[model samples]
Target chain A: MKTKVYNKQAFIALQSILVKEITRYFRIWIQTLLPPAITMTLYFVIFGQLIGSRVGLMEGVSYMEYITPGIIMMSVITNSYSNVASSFYSAKFQRNVEELLVAPVPTLFILLGYVFGGVSRGMITGVIVTLVASQFVELQINNWAIVCFVVILTSMMFATAGLVNAVFAKSFDDISIIPTFVLTPLTYLGGVFYSIKMLPEFWQNVSLANPVLYMVNAFRYGFLGVSDIPIENAIALIIFFIVGLFSIAYYLLAKGIGIRS
Target chain B: MKNKAIAISDLKKTYSNGFEALKGISFEVAEGDFIALLGPNGAGKSTTIGVICSLVNKTAGSVSVFGHSIDQHLEAAKRCIGLVPQEFNFSQFETCQQIVVNQAGYYGVPRHIALERAEVVLKQLDLWDKKDSQARMLSGGMKRRLMIARALMHEPKILILDEPTAGVDIEIRRTMWTFLRELNEQGTTIVLTTHYLEEAEQLCRNIAIIDHGTIVENTSMKDLLSRLDIETFILDVDSVPNELPKLENVEYRIRDESTIEIDVPKEKALNQVFESLTEKGIRVLSMRNKSNRLEELFVQLTERAQVVDREQKNEN
Candidate 1:
C-alpha cells in the first residue's frame, strides 16, 4: 500500500480561492457589499426604530433589540449564500471552472474554498449590519459563544446551500428563483419581527416547522437571553442542520451531482 | 528511460445518456515523448484528457502515472500532470501572474516558490511584460500563452494541452510551437490535441488517430507515413518538357510546360528518375516532395467514421 503525504497545497488552494471570491465581490464592493449594508440599515431604521416605536414590545424585549440579531443573521445567510451561488455559477457560465475541476485538489477542499469565500463575505456584511443595529437597539450578548457559533454555523449552512444551487442552476435565473420565492418568504414569516407565542396553537406548530425560526430565535436569544424555543434545543437543531447540510453537500460534490464529469 | 511517464490501460467512459464517449483507450507515453491525439470533433479526444486529468469520471478502466495507480493516488498522479485547456477559461478578473501562481498553489508549492516559477514561465512564454494585466484585458494570443504559463508553473512531468493555439494569430502560433518544442526537449511528455494536422506532423513523434469514440490508429509517425505509400514530387525543369519523364514506378504531368508533377511509390528509387533527366542534359530545377503525412491519415479516419454512420443510418 502506498501512502500519500500531507497536502499543504489544499490549504493554499483554499486561501487563494477565498481571496479570489472575496475580491470578486469587493472589486464591486459598492454593488455587492455596500448596497446590502445600506438596505439593511434602512430596514432597521424604518421597521425597528420607526415602526417598533408604535408596535411596542413582543416577547417582553424592545422591538429594536428583537429584530437586530435576526436581521444580522438574515444578511449573513443571504450574502454568504448568494456569494458562492453566483460565483460558482459564473465560473460554470464562463467555463473557467474547468481549470480547478481539472486540478488535482480534493473535491472537499474546493467546496470549502468556495464556501469560506461566501462565508467570509457574509460575516463581513453581518458585522457591518450588527454595528449599525447597535446604535438603534442597544444590543447585548447573553452568551458570546452562542452568538459567534450560530453566526459561523449559519454562514456555513448558507454557503453550502448556495453551492448546491449553483450546481443545479442551468442559467442565471435559476439561482435567484429560490432566493426570491422561497428564501424571502420563509424568512419574512420566520419570527423576524414577532414571536410565535403571539400566534394561536395550530399556527404556532406550523411556525415551528420553519428552520429559520429556530435559527433566528436562537440567534436572538444569544443577544437578549430570550427565545421562542429552548436555547439548548436551538443549538442542537443548528448543529443538526449543519451536519445534515454538510453531509448532503459532501455527498453531492463527491457524486458530482450536476457537476462531476 | 523513465519507465513510461504515463501508462494508460483499457480506459472507458459511458455517459449517463448511454453515449459511449470512449471505448477502452490504451496507450503509453515515455518521458520526453510528444504524442498527438488527432481526430475530428466528438472523437473522444477531450474525454481521454478529461479521464487522465480526473475531471471526467470513467465508467470502466484503469490508468497509472509514474508507477502509481490513479484510483489509489489521485493527488500523486495529478501532482505529476498539468493541463492547458482549449478555452480561455480562467478568472478573468485576476492578473496574468495571479492566474499562474494561484494554479501553482493548488499543486501545493509554497508561495515564494510559486512566484519564482511564475516569473520564469511568464518570461519563457513572452508574457512577463503583461504580468500585471488581467486576462480580460489581454488579447486572445496573450491569454493562450498565459494559460500555457500557468500550466507550466508547477513543472509537472506530463503536460497535456487541449488546442492551445487553436484560434490564435500566425505569429503567436509559431511562437507557441517553438516554446513547446523547447519544453519537450527539456523532457516534459507533451500530449497535444489539435485540429491542425500540420502541427502533429511537425511536433509529435507518436500519433493516435481516434474517431467515433475509439482508437482508429496508433503508431510512430514514420511508420504511419511509410504505410501511406504515395508521394507527389514537383520537379521544375529549366525549360518546358516536350514530353513527360519516362521512368518506371512514376507518373508525371507538365506544369506551365516547365514544372513536371511526379507521383510515385515513396519506396521507389527516385535517383534513377533523376539520373535519366540529367542524362537528357536537362537543367535541374527546384524539387518539392509532398509526403502524405498525418493530414491524409486524419482525413481518412474522420471520413471513414462518417461513412460508417451513413451505413448504420441506412440499415436502420
Candidate 2:
C-alpha cells in the first residue's frame, strides 16, 4: 500500500512538470513551435525545390524526398535539445527549480519529467515540420514502427543532453553557447541535405564519428529504406546515447549540481 | 512529552568556497510548537533551514523530520515539511493559481484536490481575486503571501518559513500573523526565521538564537524574556519637569519638551515609576517599550557570543 501511494504521487509529480513545460512552449507558440516550422519550410523550399532540380537521383529517389526525413529529424534534434535546455535554465534563473528540489518527488521523476517534456516538444515540432514538408513534396513511409521508434528515441537522447547542459549552465549565455557552437555545426555536417556516401573515404570515416549522423541516417532509413550506416548500428548507437545522457542528467540532479547550495 | 517534530543533531555545513555556514548547531522543535530560529545576518539561520529542506548539502551531522532521517529517508522527511523560502521563487509567468496548484502537485496531491486546495489557500491569503494574474504582476507583500499559500496547499505537518515578512508593511504583517496563529492553534508545527524581533516575540512560544555559526540561546519565549536585566521605556508626558525625579537604580533622560526615556531594571516595579512621576508632577500620557523585549535579549546574547568568539580567536 505504501509503494502504491508513492507511485501514485510520483506519477502526479511527473504530470505536473510535463504539463508546465508543455504549457510554457504552447503559451509562447510564436517563439517555440512557429520558428522551427518556418525554418524547415524554408529548407524544403530552397534545398528541396530550387536546388534539387539541378541535382537529382543521388539516392535513387527525388532530391526532395531524400531530404525530407533528414529535415524532419533535424527539427526533432534541435527542438528537443533547445526545449529542455531553455526551460530548465530559465527555471534555474528564476530560482523556481526549488519547487521540485524541496518536494518529496523522486529525482528520477523530475529528470524524466523534463526529458519527456522536451521529447513532447520535439515530436510536436517534427510533426509540424513534416506537415510543412508535405506542402512541397509527398512523403512515403517505408516502415512506420521504425520511423516512430527512431524519432522518439532520438528526441529523448537530445532532450537528456539538453538537461545536462541546463544543469551546468550558470547564465543565459552559457545555455546558448552549446547550441550555437556545438549543435548547429554538428547538425549541418550530419548529412541533413546530402548523403555521407557522396564524401571521400577519409571524410566518410570522420563523418561516422558524428553521433547526429547516425540519427539522421536511421531516420532516413526508416522513411526511405536506405542508409549509409546499417539500420542495426544506427538503432544501437541511438539507444547507447539515450542511456548515457540519461545517466549523466540523473546524476547531476541527484547531486544538486548548480541548483542547490 | 510532546513528540519531536524536528531533530537536528550537530548539523554542520561548509560551502564550496570554504565558508562554514553552520558550526555543529543542535536543536529540536516539539510537535505543534511555534518556534523562532533567530539569527543575525549570515549567522547560519538560512543555511540551517536549507539543510533541513535538503536544499543545501550538510558536510556533517544529521537532521530528522518526524522521525525520518534526511539522508536515509529524504522523501518521507520532505513530505512533512512545507517551506516558504526567503525569496520569491515562483516563475514570474505562472499564474497565482497555477503556482499554488503546481506546488501541491509536486507533493503528490491529485489535480482536483490541488485545485480545491489552491482556492482555499488563495482565499485564505486574500489572493482569490488575483488568482489568474501572473506572479510578477503581484506586489511584494502579495508575492510573499502567495508563497505562503503555495507552501500550505499540501497541508504538511511542519511549515518552515524563512524571513516570511522581511519587507512587508505592519498591517499586512499583522494579518499574516493572525493567519499563522490560527495555523498553529490547529496543531501545525511552525518554524519561522524573521529579522522582525517583534514578530518573533509575538508569534513564537519558543526561541532559538544563533550567532557566529552556533546556537547561543535556546529556551521558551517566557523564560528567555525573563533573562533581560533591563528594559528601556519611552514615556510621553504632558510637560517636561525642570528637575528630573531621581529613583533608586533607575536612570532617566529627557528627549524633548514632552517626552522622556527611562531604564527600569527587572527588580523595579512599573508602578513605582508611575508613583515617582506623580510626585514629580510630570504627567505621563503614554508609555511603551523602547525596544522589543526579545530584541533586547537577542542583542545581548549575540553580542556576548561575538565577544566569546573574539576571545577564542585571540587564544588561538
Best by TM-score: 2
Best by lDDT: 2
For model 1, give the RMSD to the true fold: 3.2
DockQ of predictions, in order shown: 0.61, 0.87
Stretches of candidate 2 exceeding 4 Å from the true structure: A1-6
Q: Which ten residues in a row have the lowest lDDT in candidate 1 chain A?
A: A2-11
| Tens-digit per-residue lDDT, B208-260, candidate 1 | 88888778888888888777777778887888656555777787777776777
Query: Which segments of model 1 are wrong by more than 4 Å?
Result: A1-6, B233-247, B253-262, B267-292, B301-316
Q: Give per-residue CA lDDT, model 2, range A181-229, as digits (tens).
A: 9998898899988899899999999999999999999999889999999
lDDT of 2 by residue, B73-105 (tens): 999999999999999999999999999888899
| Candidate 2: docking tier | high
* TM-score per candidate, chains pooled: 0.91, 0.97
TM-score computed on alpha carbons, candidate 2: 0.97
Q: For residues A1-261, what per-residue lDDT tens digits would candidate 1 score against the true structure?
A: 976454677888777687678878888798778977798889998998789889888667788878888899889888988998999999888877776776677778888988899889988998899888877777778988889888888888888889988988999999999899988888888898888988999999999888888889888888888889887777788788778877887788777677657
